[model samples]
Each structure stands twice: as C-alpha cells, then as structure tokens.
Target: MSDKPLAPAIEGWHTMGDQPHLIGTRCTACGTYFFPKQSHYCKNPDCDSTDFEEVELSRTGTVWSYTNACYEPPAPFVAPQPFEPYAIAAVQLEAEQMVVLGQVVTGVDTEQLSVGMPVELVLETLHETDDDIKVTWKWKPVAA
Candidate 1:
C-alpha cells in the first residue's frame, strides 16, 4: 500500500499532479478532438478515418452552462457524508469547440458562476481510503 494517490477515477482522462490537462484524441483526418479519448475511430459522422493521435486538451474554457445537485443521488453514486450540494458545469473548450461537463472545485457555487465565465481544469480528490485517494478532474472558475 504505497502512499501515492490512487489511479484516476476514469483512466486516461487527465494526468495527475502539477500542470495537468485533459488527455484527448484528435482525428488526424478531420481535425476533430475528443475527450476520454477515441481510440477506435474518428467520431465525425462524415469521416470514416481510424487514425487518431493523443493530444492534451486546452486547460481553459468558458462556462457554457451549470447546475447544482441539491439532492443525494441514488445508489451506485456515492455522496459525501453530511450531504451537501455540489455544482456542475458544462465548459466549452475554445480550441476544440466542445463542451465538457464536470463538478466545480470546492467553494465555488452556482451563485459565483455564470455563462461565459472563464474556467480552468484542476485535479481534486473525490474520495479517500486508508490505502489511497481517488482523484478526478474538476472545473474551477478563473480569478478576475
């Protein structure tokens, strides 16, 4: 049981530690980029190319939309004890022209966010155990 943090909640999404950016796949044929990586084939409906290259997505994006989870989710979804609401946002990466959804970093709430607000990617602990801490990517509103 090494002390290092556990693997990412979803493998191959983002690297851990300083200077992290979401890992995505870019279709060399159509110039399409996909987060979570598209290893099988190009996602562009008009293209049938299977060639892709892994690339780091932009670190900054604009808040395209947001919502708050006021209620605890059903089973299989774990919520922190002493349940508290969390904010989620759809951030539009400028270079990719795609919106990625993720939880907002702690201390940021719906009140502090608005459409078109600048945001950056961050790594956060989703949960921890005696052995390791589960990490995931989160969105944080950029400072003025």
Candidate 2:
C-alpha cells in the first residue's frame, strides 16, 4: 500500500496544505458563491444562470457563531473511545459572504472563543485504521 494518506472525508471541499482553502463555486452571472460547490446552477434566487466557475474560498474569516458539543455525536461521527467534548464554529468567509460550519482545532474550548474573532482553515486527522487515515478540515482561531 502507498504511504500517502487516504482521500479526504469530504471530497471537493479542500486540498491538504500548509495554507489550505475551501474550494467553492462562484456564479459568473450574479457573483454568488457557494461552498461544496454548485456545479449545476447558481443558488441565488434572483439569478437563473447555469454558468459557474470553481474558485478557492478565502482562508480567513470571522467567527459568526460557536458552540461546544458536551455529548457524543450521532452515528457516522466516530469519537474516541474515551469521549471528550469538542467545539464547533460557524465562520463567515468575508469575500464569499457565507458561513461554513466545522469543528474547531483541538484544545480550543467555548471559553476561549468569541464571535467576530479571526479563524483559518486547517487539515486534521479525523480517524485512522491499519491501512489509512481519514482527514477533514477544521477551523482554528488565529493568533493576533
């Protein structure tokens, strides 16, 4: 087997890197942007265009909201055997004018986060098996 890590948990969202940015689609008709990409059509209600272009979303954004998960998540979400609470954040990408939700980097608790704080995208291991490791993107608070 190859040594490279397995494919991302969610495909077409981002690529692994020291400075990873979310991949999204932008409408050439009305300038609307969408995360997870809308390959078929633009999401804006006023726009009925099917033309779109792939673009890398901004790396930095302000925290729009946040919360801490004090309990184990539902199935499909694999937590460590000895479960620990984790924080989730809704970050607003400035240029895109959209908010994307993701888990916060380890060690950042609800007490240490605030709305409007700057955050950046990061790649982290979600789970691992004998053959490969699953990776996902996360949000981390940016140092001033």
Q: Using Cα atoms with residue i matched to residue i, what is each candidate's TM-score against the true structure?
A: 0.92, 0.93
Candidate 1: stretches off by over 4 Å: 1-6
Q: What is the C-alpha lDDT of each candidate?
A: 0.88, 0.88
Please report the candidate that would top TM-score against the real structure. 2
Candidate 2, residues 38-111, lDDT tens digits: the string is: 97977788999999999999998999999989999887988887988989999998888899999999899999
lDDT of 1: 0.88
Give the Cα error of residue 31 in candidate 1, in Å. Answer: 0.8
Checking candidate 1 for backbone clashes, the offending pairs are: none
